[model samples]
Target: MTNQIPAENTLSIEEVQAAFAKSYGGLVGQLTLQNLSLEKQVQSLQSRLSDVEEIAFGLKRDNANLIKSQVTLEAEIAALIKAGPTADQIAAQGKAVIDYEDTETIASFAAANYGKEKAAPVEAA
Candidate 1:
């Protein structure tokens, strides 16, 4: 008796290989798409990182300049304290010399223009 295999029950090797290849190709396509998406995300993050680094560098530079200015100002203040006040500065601190004529003119202008009755205050609600 000859042994016979049923066609419906038997799968061909070529058919199995083709099925496996098709499934593998589909998986590879999905993985490729995922990889592309991840790459884009990485690129975006890198771009953001670059921008933050630039901003941080600028802030550092600005802070350094401010520190230098502060040091210079402190040194100038120290020198000024060491040297004491100038003659003109000491003279300016002395009592003012009033000009009586100017004072009288200013007082007359005030009396003429601002001696009127004051405005009544408004009542708050």
Candidate 2:
């Protein structure tokens, strides 16, 4: 007689495998949902990174423009210094440009700025 296991004491291997498959299916579904959530988070982070990069690029451009403006202003100031009397000097001396050919205007300016005793005598041409 061959040794035989009682059918009630042992479960069929197929039934155990089916139970495992059902549990694993649920776990797989949960994992799929978690994966989708993670993907969305990654997309959000990437979008934010792109926005930050754009802002950095704009700031760099603005900084470059400001530097260029500063250099241009410095060069202009240097040229003005080389040219001659600055606004400060002109203001301090109270000097004004007058048309030399306008004798009447020159006479008026001379009379206003200088007393007749110190003013140059006007010559009649």
Candidate 3:
């Protein structure tokens, strides 16, 4: 059967309106995808910042502890000298204790800062 339809009857106004609505929906979907991707990136960055803050706080705590220990050590050394352990022996033993404490403090400071997860600067170098 061969039949021809007039252009006016080819598409109704209702059909045109429906087509436009579908196109608008597709556009909204694309925008929503972009919005979600941005949100994910923001969350990732926030997590990284939080990790850094935690490491900084831990380092501060380590420094506080080290200072307290150093003060106690000083007081103990003064008392030992007052007790008369002689000069040379007192000096040698005291120096050994101080050296050990210093090394431990340095190691703790480094660990607290980066948690063995990253490279750090050498203080003496």
Candidate 4:
């Protein structure tokens, strides 16, 4: 059972096509605008991602340098521990012995020079 439209009620093929074209054009214009907006959003996200990647790379490089420095410092500490203190360091720990005459001479010199200033030389005319 096929239903048939009356000739008076039926639309012409050209009218239907014109209506479809108008609808299709409107939809296409909307889709085009949406596509452009999405593209811009994607580009903005890509730019932000690039900046984040650069920051991450710098942080990774800095972390590597810090780790290397830490390793170098640890090695130096280990070497110093194995080598032990120098002779000068050991000698510095010993008791210092000062002679009585040297102490008296230093005391006398300081007492003599205390509050005394050298006289300025006369300027030539």
Candidate 2 stretches with Cα past 4 Å from truth are 1-9, 81-125
- Give the higher-TM-score candidate: 2 or 3: 2
RMSD of each: 16.7, 8.8, 22.2, 14.2
lDDT of 4 at 57: 100
Better of 1 and 2 by lDDT: 2
Provide the TM-score for each candidate, comma-separated. Answer: 0.58, 0.57, 0.42, 0.63
lDDT of 2: 0.75
TM-score, prediction 1: 0.58
Model 4, which residues run further than 4 Å from truth?
1-3, 83-125
Best of the two (1, 2) by TM-score: 1
Global lDDT of each candidate: 0.69, 0.75, 0.74, 0.68
Worst 10 residues of 1 by lDDT: 116-125
State the weakest 10-residue window (summed lDDT) of model 2.
90-99
Candidate 3 residue spans exceeding 4 A from truth = 1-16, 73-125
Q: Write the per-residue lDDT of candidate 2 for residues 2-118, one digit (tens) a residue.
A: 899988988789988999999999999999999999999999999999999999999999999999999999999899887666456444334332335555555545555576554
Better candidate number, 1 or 3, judged by TM-score: 1
